[model samples]
Target chain A: AQTVTQSQPEMSVQEAETVTLSCTYDTSESDYYLFWYKQPPSRQMILVIRQEAYKQQNATENRFSVNFQKAAKSFSLKISDSQLGDAAMYFCAYRSAVRYQGGSEKLVFGKGMKLTVNP
Target chain B: AAGVIQSPRHLIKEKRETATLKCYPIPRHDTVYWYQQGPGQDPQFLISFYEKMQSDKGSIPDRFSAQQFSDYHSELNMSSLELGDSALYFCASTQGWGRANEQFFGPGTRLTVL
Candidate 1:
């Protein structure tokens, strides 16, 4: 079984500053995927960024990026030049690699961290 | 391209009644997923479908059921609505079954059971 944990329940950052959301996971499988999702007040879950275990390079999407530490089982999301639009509930998720049996690839998500971008 | 679309943006149902939510995936998407989101909680995976076949189901109850149509649209049905079932339901679509692929989500349907 796989599990994702977000230790920070809430985070705040001033506009134009940077913020980092912590995430950790427990998985025995070597090959897997990590993801960060953002949910705004509208309650829509949006994909922020993704990281593949096989690739050491962290994923970056404009101001959003991930610091993936495979050995430490840590995958943290960093939002640079934070804007008010960045305020939302962020979630960390994990999915196992594809198996020969064609098993289900369901995402196991963390509790979520509420990010507040102060002006 | 248009993202995932879910019908009945808001629904109000009475206890013991049945409710059905609809979702239309983006064209050419092979996988569709359903999730439930309560207030102040992360979205939880309910089920997923690929090529009209149920690929996975999470820790959902028997009253919760889903079906995928040939057009790639999916429907989530609740046999007996309960207060606890009141939450936001999201439908998502992905290009493939690979874990590394990103899933696009719909705006979601807010279900209120009284």
Candidate 2:
């Protein structure tokens, strides 16, 4: 069994500033994938970024990036130059790399952190 | 690029009533996944299909049933609905069974039980 943990329930940052949301997971599998997703007021789940456990290089997508510490079981999201539109509930998710029963693995998600960007 | 499609963006059903949700995966995607999101809670995996066959099961209730058709579209049938079942139902799709492929999520169907 695998579980993702987001310790901080909520966080706020001033516009144009940067903020980091922390996440950790428990998994015995060596090969797995981690992701960060954002849910806005519309309730749409949007993928922010993803990282593979086998890759040491962090994943970056424009202003969004991940600091993946595999040995520490930590994967955190860094939002640089935050904007009002970035205010949303962010979730950290995990998935195993091994295919089970001929199907792709299911995602295990954290409780989510509410991010508020104050103007 | 085409994205995953889910119909009846909003549904209102009474307790003990039944509802059916539909999902149309992006063209060429062979896998479909279903998830449930409660109010102010993280999404939980319910079930998944691969190539029209049941692949994985999660916390889905026995009163609920789902299947993927030959066309790659999937339907989730819920019976004896309860207040707890009134949540956002999301359908996600992926092109293959690869380990690193990102799952594209649908807009999700919001089912409200009264």
Best-matching candidate per lDDT: 2
Q: List the residue pairs that clash in candidate 2.
A: none
Candidate 2 per-residue lDDT over residues A1-119, each given as its tens digit: 89999999999999999999999999878888899999999999999999988899999999999999999999999999999999999999999886532333899999999999999
Question: What 10-residue stretch in candidate 1 chain A is worst by lDDT?
Answer: A95-104
Worst 10 residues of 1 chain B by lDDT: B94-103
Chain A TM-scores, all candidates? Answer: 0.96, 0.95
lDDT of 1 by residue, A28-99 (tens): 888888999998888888889999898999999999999999999999999999999999999999888776
What lDDT score is found at residue A84 in candidate 1?
95
Residue B46 C-alpha lDDT in model 1: 97
For every candidate in turn, the CA RMSD to the true structure comes to 1.3, 1.5
Best by DockQ: 1
Whole-model Cα lDDT per candidate?
0.90, 0.94
CAPRI-wise, candidate 2 is: medium
